[model samples]
Target chain A: MKRKYFQRKFDIRTYECDFKGQLHPLALFNFMQELASTHADRLGFSVQKLMQQKMTWVLSRLHLKINKPLRWGETLTGRTWPSGRVGKYALRDFQFFNQTGETTAVGTSSWMVIDLEKRQPLKLDQLFTSDVSLKKRALADDFPALPEIDNSENQCKFAVRFSDLDLNRHVNPVSYIAWALESLPEPVLFRHYPMEVEVSYRKEVFLGDQVICKLQQIQGTESLSYIHKLFLEKNGQEIARLRTLWK
Target chain B: MKRKYFQRKFDIRTYECDFKGQLHPLALFNFMQELASTHADRLGFSVQKLMQQKMTWVLSRLHLKINKPLRWGETLTGRTWPSGRVGKYALRDFQFFNQTGETTAVGTSSWMVIDLEKRQPLKLDQLFTSDVSLKKRALADDFPALPEIDNSENQCKFAVRFSDLDLNRHVNPVSYIAWALESLPEPVLFRHYPMEVEVSYRKEVFLGDQVICKLQQIQGTESLSYIHKLFLEKNGQEIARLRTLWK
Candidate 1:
């Protein structure tokens, strides 16, 4: 029988933690991505395996909700499983829990297989037919589409460095999340912690590329929210959009 | 008998690897930092313990020699131990090996204890005495001082992002190395791999700080060398210096 889920244990390293000694959100995303890749590998669809067929998985969207902070030196158990397909997108869900077994975060991601040479998305049905639980999901709610920011109060520009590239030779998706958060106000960044984050990746970025990040804040009754948009500076192409809720 | 050394095991995550699927030097530094911190913690000199005493350990200088490239999904065993005091500086040594027991890297680092309130360095003798291997050294050669780069051929500027800060609320030391390498030529970065690196931390950088990295290349008969200097863009204060040998 094939395993329906995969779980891995992680010990939070000191460098992976923030000023509060808690695991940074980027580290959490790395953990989730690792777990998901391992699960996919077990099902014979890893990046290495896919590369043999001139195809690779691209993370198009992800939504993560942090319920509790994972602290340094703490052990985190991350679990992920396939949640079947949604049109041309392959869906995966993740859950993170501390050693005490309390849920720390839940995340859902959408992926698409792309032809490496052609740079075009491939239909999920033609490539994968893994046994997925169509009804199981770490997050039950569907993510609302994040709108592009037009009138932005804060902006930051970044030149993609060599360190930003991963195995795909493109800027790692987590850097986009970091750039989005970097454009927020100092008060919002220092005074509040992000509780929920939704990201939609529209284009790929490469080394030596320049990008601009724009952010707009929205004050809510209970918490503060921000809309972030990242664009390629060369052609004004929107590379990614993000929505973050903080408390 | 007092324990003289500490060891830890790690599995390289996918995100930690580069385009060639080999572990990045930055990730290696993170692992080394984590292992060193854990050793200090085990010996009752961790960051938490020092912070409670209104003091903290500051890394002053480090020299690393890489013998082999660690790849994704491989198991790495890291070992570190105190090498006693060198004047006002306390020294530590590190060695990393793969599962097959081949040495992958060796490093030596100097650290100083600083009074947090006054931002003053304290004498090593003032700290509690701990038994260390004074004769054992990971790398026998003492690091030569890196000179400032006057006529730099390449330059890059970066604003300290929120993600760059660690528990000390200062830009983590690894970012300094990354910034130094970011100024190198693209061919040197992609065609060759760094074999040896030496860094000296002259000052601390905080959020909202803008820093400029300058690099000068030296062509040698056997290999290529780079001299890097990082300065505060606001005041031109030199923050760090580095020398990297690549093959």
Candidate 2:
């Protein structure tokens, strides 16, 4: 059934590159949004129509690992599917492949239905049913585990700038990777691919707040599977912790 | 100095919007990148030279505020400046204004100088230092403060998808706002003339982890804000938190 959903291809544009001349992580999210929205449309549901009904789907969580870096003008394909559904929540997966079909990155997302009018959560039965199936095979087995952190000795600091906020009036999660990765030397970061990352949010960061990010390398094989923790700290207080894996 | 850094205005493009047809926050970051890079060239320091010298300026942190939603095909002036320098870091500022000089968004970023080859931090003395007196004076002073989050109750959760990750190999911050805002009813989000937001990064979100975002109304004001926390429960333990503010 997953095969029913069409695979989409995209080309990275020049504008998407950072000073280092690589595709920005946020841009990839934009592409995935397009792919998911298009896939939903193909499955007989339109995000627009959902909005009209005061019903929206929110992404609840995500886990990703990148094996190599992608550059500008590179052609890539984002293969996505609705792997399964649990009650009102739906499980979707995506695989990013280079032109040669080698997997560059793999990810999964869980979405839930919301009632926009009441601004409240809605049951899956209230929105979608078992019939809304897109019988695609799961992307892969052996999904990496979430990174482990001590939660102690985590002291990463950052200042929330005006540009870090998004239209929803919050800091975007993808920006966190940039900040965390930025802490590393550019040469190591540029040469190494992000093997895996698991990010969990605890608090919201506001403008002018000095944000603190803390990290600890847990365990890994060939750096492709190392664990790390991230969080924001203010005046020695813990805000959030992100456990991540990198290759 | 701000006046000197301000160049001719550039119009916002339609391609910048996400599925919700609103300007993606990261688009603004990209604009800032373009404006700053161009401004850097004007200041006689091209990205190429910076790279060659093994000295690169990384965006250590950022905070952003959006006062109004920008629509498709809207023309706005993007003004940027090197507000000041602190040791090996330079503080850059950006403002988006409409034709009437009405500010739409204001942003600030802290950048650090790194030795790309040695993969080490560079001291301010090792890099060029000129009194940014002219640029500092040219910067606008009356920028708005970052938006605040009102409550933590009634939060929404989202999962970062594969597309959410960019070439930078992590979730893009702008995608977080796009996803969070898209979760809202379209009519309410699109109709308002003036919308304000402030976002900070606490942790990095990757594909497959669940992110919980909470939105609440500010008291005695028409304004609203949200707290986004991205996390996953394996053995029933919390992972990460991402917070955001929107009005």
Candidate 3:
């Protein structure tokens, strides 16, 4: 039988909030990631252990649906478990709730095991075993193909610094999201609640690597929804595409 | 009689470490700040409550001496209490210790309660009532005036983004430190450990405001050290002046 999901609890801090006194999406993602890593460590598959073997986990995509608002000083519990592998991707799911057991949000992510030396993907089928049965259900209705905007505007250039590097010694995903969001104007930032987020991490960004974020804003089929496409300036490489729905 | 010191414990996370696997100076400072804030809140002078009165705590200067290396999963307890007031500055002190009761580092800070609406400082004499009796102990040996470098090199410009804004809607000190450190070359970053840090915050920066970081390398009488100055690009208004001693 599969073991119970790993759970961790924390109270949000003041600095984690934005101008509106609301919890930031970046902070939410970080809480889930911390729980995931801690859970993996208990299972003897921690990031540090993986790094020693020259294998690291790289996130490919994440989908989150927020059902409630999280604010400062609220005690919340984050629970996560490895659902199963979807083809070449290792899948994991997360759920957050308040003290009253009310669900706040749910998230699902896909990660790939990368051999650091070879810089290539490693198959998970033969590499590991788990007691939890892989859930066949997809996280979202569909993972849509982001729009291809030929013409775009370069928002800004971000230089990866020491604080941006994670245990794996590369630019972390939260930093990528922050850089992409910086490309938008202030009005777009404060206007809406992010209903859904999609990310496809293309390549590993390292220290001293210069990354220029280019953004192309498009209208979503639903009224008032906005879509932003992020790309690398030098090679025209697509980093990650994001979409947000307003209330 | 004085109240006992407020203490909080936390395990350093992997992301909070730098490339060398040691805890980042920024992260260490943040931990202390968190402890101070929580203490203030327990004393009924929390940032939120102060903001409601059109006042907020502003960090003026901080001096910390690192005697230990904090790594991922290492639990450290932060203890803080009111030391005393030096003229217009209310003094607070912090000391960190490991699980074995070994002292890791000590920190002292000066803070000002600012009238956010009037953009002025208010005397702390009548503002706060803490059970902890103020002990007359200077945080540092000498709070020296930063070098007035007539001619310095402008390193780079950092535009204040949403990520830089804290709960008070101002550019946080951590962001300021990051910008200042960015002025230094990589060789300086990895070669030495930061022994002493002194900062003088001059003016407030907001979102969309682009600040320029300037650096001037100087030889210290004791050993090796560096000084960095930051300012506004357009007005040339000073933001912060920093000094770091290396071992």
Q: What is the interface RMSD of each candidate, in Å?
A: 1.0, 8.8, 1.9
User: What TM value does model 1 have?
Assistant: 0.97
**Which docking band does candidate 2 fall into?**
incorrect
Q: Model 1, which residues run further than 4 Å from truth?
A: none
| Cα-based TM-score, every candidate | 0.97, 0.49, 0.92
Best by the DockQ measure: 1
Query: Which window of ten consecutive residues has the lowest lDDT sum in model 2 chain A?
Result: A220-229
Q: How good is model 2 by TM-score? A: 0.49
User: Candidate 1 on A1-247: residue-level lDDT in tens?
Assistant: 7788999899999999888887888888889889987888888889899999999899999999999877888999999988868777888999998888999999999999999999999988778665465459999756567876768988889989898887788999998998988888887778878889899999999997999998887654567888998999999999999999887
- C-alpha positional error of residue A161 in candidate 1 after TM-score superposition, expressed in Å: 1.3
TM-score: the better of candidates 2 and 3: 3
lDDT (tens digit, per residue) of candidate 2 on B1-247: 3345655465554335543456766677667766766677677665556867666555554556777777655777888777876666677788889878898888776666667667566876556666542345233333233344445445444545444554344566566555455444434444442244344443445655566554544455455544443334333233322334544
Q: Just chain B of model 2: what TM-score? A: 0.63
Model 3 lDDT at residue A155: 64
Structure candidate 3, residue pairs in collision: none
List chain A TM-scores, every candidate, in order: 0.95, 0.71, 0.89
Can you tell me which runs of candidate 3 are displaced by over 4 Å? Answer: A1-4, A129-144, A150-154, A217-224, B1-4, B128-132, B136-142, B150-154, B220-223
lDDT: which candidate is best? 1
